[model samples]
Target: MVEATPELTSTSDSPALAVSVLQMLRTATSVQHKALEARLPLTHADLDRSLYTRIIEAYYGFHVPLQRHIDQFVSPQACDPKRYKVAALIKDLRALGLSDGQIDRLPLCCDLPRLQTQGHLLGIMYVIEGATLGGQVLRRIIADRLGIEADSGGEFLDVYGRDTGRRWKAFLKQLADFDQPEYNGDVVDAACATFASFERWLDRAGVLL
Candidate 1:
């Protein structure tokens, strides 16, 4: 087994450390993007949305009903694409080594309820802003690593990232103002767990140093 180095394990509340993680993810994404570009047989190819749509269906279809209760807090326009179902995304999630239970509760962590109204709105905002693009970047990373061409996979990243990104950032400003430290910590922790799983699988696949 490839062991994760201490550098990878280190964590702090320091913005530096958080920025480092984000930067590392960005580097990984760039590498994967280059890999896909090199392997794709064609340039200017649109990503296959049909396959992308299935990936959506797999993940969100099951979670949609559960998330409906949480949706009332967010604007209809804001939450619309957030509701897209992606089946391949969920399958790829398994390839990233998330446990079934962890994957199952994943939506709840994003669409938090049973908290205050601001908390609920914060959860939606946090997820829509912070989580969705991260999720797409990850899918792009996987598709690229697997040598899936633009004709087959690029649309998943392009469409999902571009569309959901605007709302995500809009909600992020809203999320930063919410004062519930405990809930904020929970949200951060969930993000950490998900990313750690991604890193772990990448390490296992020998894609990370």
Candidate 2:
């Protein structure tokens, strides 16, 4: 789970029935958030190249199908290319010595959560965009412990690079449009489902802590 930093949790300027979407998402998905964080091995002190690669591999598998699915709903104005992380994951895999062919041969997650509306999509995006934060901490850990750098096999850990904050804020700004109470259920369900899906996928891939 991505840490719920203040930036991600601050109350939106616009209150939808006196409760911001951030607040609802944070409160409702707290349990699922902690569960996934506890199970992910990214923070383990002994994280090695093999273990790290497995983790990235699992993420690549998840995002390949996920990105394709989500693109269908995101409008041109809302679809920021920088928000996409699959390419970064692929770059890291290549730096780790995987050939393009091997990457193409990699398996993808099939049982993704259903997204019926843009509200559900927002919840899904919230989870995905929020996870970028863990990368900031991960970059340092992998650098000190595994001798990996963004240009090497750790690009995925710091996908947004120096602009992570800008990207996150952009996502938050986008969320402002869905602050209404009516959208709350889909947002929370999608957020929880995303965490569950990612954790279950990693566990199935044998990469969980």
Candidate 3:
């Protein structure tokens, strides 16, 4: 775990913490972000259902355990458990023909980092919530290229639907409210670790090009 520096504890305001943490980790997170995007097999001229299924399966492998861990530490009022992506992933997986048994047996991601503080929890939520924003774009691409609709195998990507932006801003407000000084380092460290762990998990699942 990376140590929180004195500088990180400088803010108690939501907007300041939000700005500071993002500025601190922007470069690190961006690298991991671009790497994941580059590895997705969406550009092929002959993308198939099997390939798309594999992609969702890999996501399932990472998110199930990841979200479970996040939920454990996240405040009940911070995020609605009902809106988490794991359920959508399960529905989409089943829609793609994976049985309940098969879904249960899907390979789990290894070496996921643990959250030790509210800041750490929010950091991980930052990554997950941020993905929903990009998912809107990915959902459109999947629909155009793979013909999967929000009610079908693409539901996971269609998270928040028309309210994606609103949900994201709400999350930011929640994050801002977590402006305690003690958690500064944990927040930034967890966010960076999340991006790295996600990249590693995706690589392990063979989803990267």
Candidate 4:
């Protein structure tokens, strides 16, 4: 692994970038939810179950990835070359003023087994990996600005990047190629909105402070 000195890029005026990334994350999640929603037979019981799944999946999808990022930041010696993405994410969270406590709790909100069973695991991974990639870029910015190695505070970023890359890529490809008979854009829109809501929550909590 190459230990490059920290190089900070300018993210002072990059709210739009955050919005774009968050939007992508949200839309993909909604696609999975909408698919499940359509599958529920229309009976009251089935409707209830479907609704439950949609709500649960949506909530879990939104928080887990962010939680993973928080977990990665506090640990040292965990960052491998691949975890550059993770480092970048910590930068974003720090920029947002997210406290260690809030960041740490994000994982508990996610359901690991159900995430895989519902086929939304990929979507969740997409959100996490995307943030991680963004984080790497952000870390460079931090390093450049601070005149230190980009991953000075967080090392796990490199570790996660290599480990999650292949699986994340496969998931995205699967999503892009997914050919379902029924197409629902509204669900995608809903997910985007959901993510936006969560982002706002972090902002309000002074995670960016």
Candidate 5:
């Protein structure tokens, strides 16, 4: 299981909450981030269909419960429910030729952290949404490596397609609007936990190439 550092009790006097949260997550989760980047199949130059399928399977395992909780806990006003990535994950898995039963049998990350509040939901959203920014780059790399496209096995990484930037900016604007000193610590803690959880999930799913 992934463990986050002890939570801070307060962040009332911190600098801009959104900026601080983002920076704190980047610094605190850097090790996990690098480990995943180094080991994920997409990072390798000699990627193959099997490796790509494994990567997608890992993603499916992590995203299923995460997205479920996000939809359950976060307000639609704060984030568009339609923008959730699980659908893309499922589409990609299907495109990879996994039968329903096979996909059902894929290992799931059952140790996902509880998301109990809007702040917690936002924090999780921060991690998943931020992934899309990197996904833009990964999409291109996967295309070059595996000859995949948005409508094919690349659905998850190619989530936003040409709308990635606009979608990200919109989410950022919404995040900025919801920024509150009282919830700052929760947001940061949630983001960090999300990263750690994802790292652990990937490790468990055997995505280390």
Candidate 6:
């Protein structure tokens, strides 16, 4: 298990030893994270191409509107220009044999987590950016089991590829700025909400095995 080190950066309002925002967020959200991961269909023992396609299709339905929701709150500079996640999903879908029209016809997730404040936005982004990092492992698993690679049909799995670790560290660095005392609740709550929203969306999409 990769452990997060909590560095204290306290305001006058905060206790002297309060955990760093990233570590706090991680401890708060770990249960939801593991629960969601458990329910994902990616690791099914009987995994095959058709199941993989449906999984990617389900992801497209969720990721499209989810990224749009994030976009509604993100400043231009806040979003990494290289993080063309929706575009990567499109590429994977195309490589998996879906025409653009079929992709357009896929049902989208509507009930999303609320992004009401900077804390909320940060919380939601924490989940997303962390998932992008986790996808590096998933990418390799898909390649081994399904014979799919980034060039073929699994581009979204490791969207950042070799830069995944660097991108994740960059994201973690930005958390330092939001280490104020008051925003912790908002951040943690939004992360939990994001996970709940995603699980509900996945349930409706019927992609989990």
Top candidate on lDDT is: 2
- Higher-scoring candidate on TM-score, 4 or 5: 5
Question: Where in model 5 is the C-alpha error above 4 Å?
Answer: 1-20, 75-79
- Residue-level lDDT tens digits of model 2 in 11-100: 478443466788778877777878777778778877888988888889999999999888877766777787788999999999988899
For model 4, give the 10-residue run with minimal summed lDDT: 110-119
Model 5 C-alpha lDDT versus the unseen true structure: 0.77
TM-score for each of the candidates: 0.37, 0.89, 0.83, 0.38, 0.83, 0.89
Considering TM-score, which of the candidate structures 4 and 6 is the better prediction for this target? Answer: 6
Residues 1-209, model 6: lDDT tens digits: 22444455678997777677788887777777777777886876788888888888888888899888877788777877687588888999999999999999999989989888998888887888888877888888899998999989999898888888998888777777877878878888888898898888888878764
Q: Model 5 TM-score?
A: 0.83
List, residue by residue over 42-125, the lDDT tens digit for candidate 5.
868778889899989989898887777776676658657668788888888888899889988988788887688777777787
Question: Cα miss at 12, model 3 (Å)?
Answer: 25
How many backbone collisions does model 3 have? 2
Model 4 quality (TM-score) = 0.38
- The residue pairs found clashing in candidate 2 are none
| Candidate order (lDDT) | 2, 6, 3, 5, 1, 4
Kindly report which residue stretches of model 2 are placed more than 4 angstroms away from their true locations once superposed. 1-17, 75-78
1-209 per-residue lDDT for model 3 (tens digits): 12223334334564443335554545446666676667777555556789889989988999999877766666768758756888899999999999999999999887676688778887788888888877888788889988899888999888789889998888778776775556767877888788888878878888768
Steric clash pairs (candidate 6): none
* RMSD after Cα superposition, model 5: 5.2
